[model samples]
Target chain A: MSPAQHEPDEDPGAPASSHAVSAPGAPSAARPKVPRRVAWRRLSTISRARLSRGTLLAALLTLVLGLALVAQVRSTQTADLENLRETDLIALLDDVTDRADRLEDEVRSLEQDRSRLESGGGDAAAAQAAQSRLESYQILAGTVPVSGPGVSVRVSDPEGEVTTTMMIDLVQELRDAGAEAIQIGPARVVATTWIGVDEGRLTVDGQPVAAPYSVVAIGDGHTLAGALAIPGGFNDSVRRVGGEVQVTEGEELVIDAVHEPPTLEHARPVPPSEGR
Target chain B: MIPVLGLVVGVVLGLMLQPEVPGWLEPYLPIAVIAALDAVFGGVRASLEGIFNDRVFVISILSNVLVAGLIVFLGNQLGVGAQLSTGVVVVLGLRIFSNVAAIRRHLLGA
Candidate 1:
């Protein structure tokens, strides 16, 4: 190709002239060329168009929904905490009710025993046996002081994500392990007692188990520990889901005194031989 | 917006009416209705697309019902039935997210 044909299109002065003028004045002159408002408007329109109405609505809805979800979760947690509190109180009330009924029964039984003792009747031996049984029950209730070297076990459900059933299973296992005396959240260990869940929350006795369920029992520490660590023990299951089971040996684990059980004074007194 | 509004209204109405209704049927019907509607709409669309497997639908339906049932049952058993219901509500809140996401994807192709 001819040099003229290849290069003839260039305006030799065009580059220099535009460069000199545009370099110094270009920025200042162009400053107002596209106003800030116009640029912003263009950008806003582009973004608005790119983000469709449906998507925006969906996003906004999702945001509101997410907030609601968070609120719901928080409220749930709070309610669970409150329920935990109430469960303890209910357990306490139940214990008290049971105690009152038991005391009435015991007083009546004692009156019968007193009459039999005074009568110097053949049922005297039988009356003594009844009295012994009553004593044991009273000890079990913590109304009478019974002391021995035993371990205390505490089993508590964790603060978050622990179920009531799991706590009950643990308590049962402990009792099976020969825990002489056990205290769950607030419920004292007793023959008629069963671990109960209240409001998605579990309580022992009459106390709320704040997370990390505290299962306190009085028994042989070694035996209790072994029982809890067995294959089907509370320890194994608790460990499966990152829970804690602690055992401590002590010289004394004084269960605060509980009330006496009731007896039916109206129950017929059997003959000594028959009672034996 | 419309769906959210509908949900809010429905929830409020159900909550207000709950106390006035008979004890036995009052608690279950509202939740069951919502779940049913969700399943019906979801199933119709998925089935038309040949993606509605019986197993998936059954499992989802059973799980949803079980959760609702357990919340009520546990709450009653524990004497904290209301609190457990709160947990159920949290799960429902999550379902709302998934539902909204599905709707958005279907309508906007995004």
Candidate 2:
């Protein structure tokens, strides 16, 4: 490598003359004018490239690694399980336990009913009537799982702007559309059901519900869906509050939620003849 | 120069596409990325030392990712996945630091 080819002020301690040997041209006034340092940096990078093809290969590999790093970081950060704190873990465990208990109780009661029906110890007609009455009571009490043709409504508040009033209005609209049985998330909506905001989160019967909230109502699917899509109905209200409502009509919608039956403390059934 | 351009393009593509890594591969991705980073830093250091070899760099990159993943997989099979993952990360992290230090000294003359 010639002395003139190398910049006099380039790093004297640079390990090798490979850069000078591979430099495209010595700095000259006639050449396209760039600052000496910039030219030196560019030439050095080019010279490094000329030394071996490995530098380019390494760059490509680094590029891929960079992309993977960014993607992995994002995925890891967004992972819900990974971000769970101790309280969140405990809450998840509680939820699982509650669900398991509910299912077990349901199975046990259903097995008992089947055994009673198969034994045939009672009068068939009277037993049938009693069974039908029990089912009606269970449905009214919201203590029995119900499934039939209905509409499923999903509400999402992406901006956290949905208020309690909007949800109340939604429920009222569903009832007006003749919703026989309704469920919001895991809570069954009944006469005693309470919906409110607790600490900025929507809660049903004191249990926090997360978005997007799925509401399943057993009723006339077309009527229920139409009710939500009316000119200034639930859908419009959701939009006005920076939320979204998606209503889907389906032939079979299952709402397998059972609420605790309310106990009557003061009120009693009046004698048949004395009823006002 | 071409490699740098490729790198920029790769980043843009990654951002635009946002490809999902499979759930099964998620566990190994972080380790693989760290191992690849170690190889990249080592390559930079070697280049500054005038001993950069493309074949060696490529081989190291492949081996690093494979070996890191293998260690984690084996650890999972043996019921010690978390411990072994930590071990792999610590070792690779040290190597990355040393290589980065070398590169800094070479570039900054400090």
User: How does chain A of every candidate compare to the true chain A by TM-score?
Assistant: 0.44, 0.53
Q: Write the per-residue lDDT of candidate 1 for residues B11-95, one digit (tens) a residue.
A: 5544444323333634443454444334334432233222333444444444555557666776778887667666656545444
TM-score, candidate 1, chain B alone: 0.57
Interface RMSD, one decimal, each candidate: 21.9, 9.7
DockQ computed for model 2 against the true two-chain complex using alpha carbons: 0.12
- Compose the digit string of candidate 1's lDDT tens values, residues A168-269: 776677677777776654456676565555666665554455665555667776777777778866777776766666767777766653534557577688
For A29-142, candidate 2 gives per-residue lDDT tens digits of 322233445434643874543534655675677678867877787777678775344457789999999999999999999999999887777667988899999997888679
Scanning candidate 1 chain A in windows of ten residues, the lowest lDDT window is A12-21
* Full-model lDDT for every candidate: 0.51, 0.74
Just chain B of model 2: what TM-score? 0.92
Standalone chain B TM-score for every prediction: 0.57, 0.92
DockQ for candidate 1, please give it. Answer: 0.01
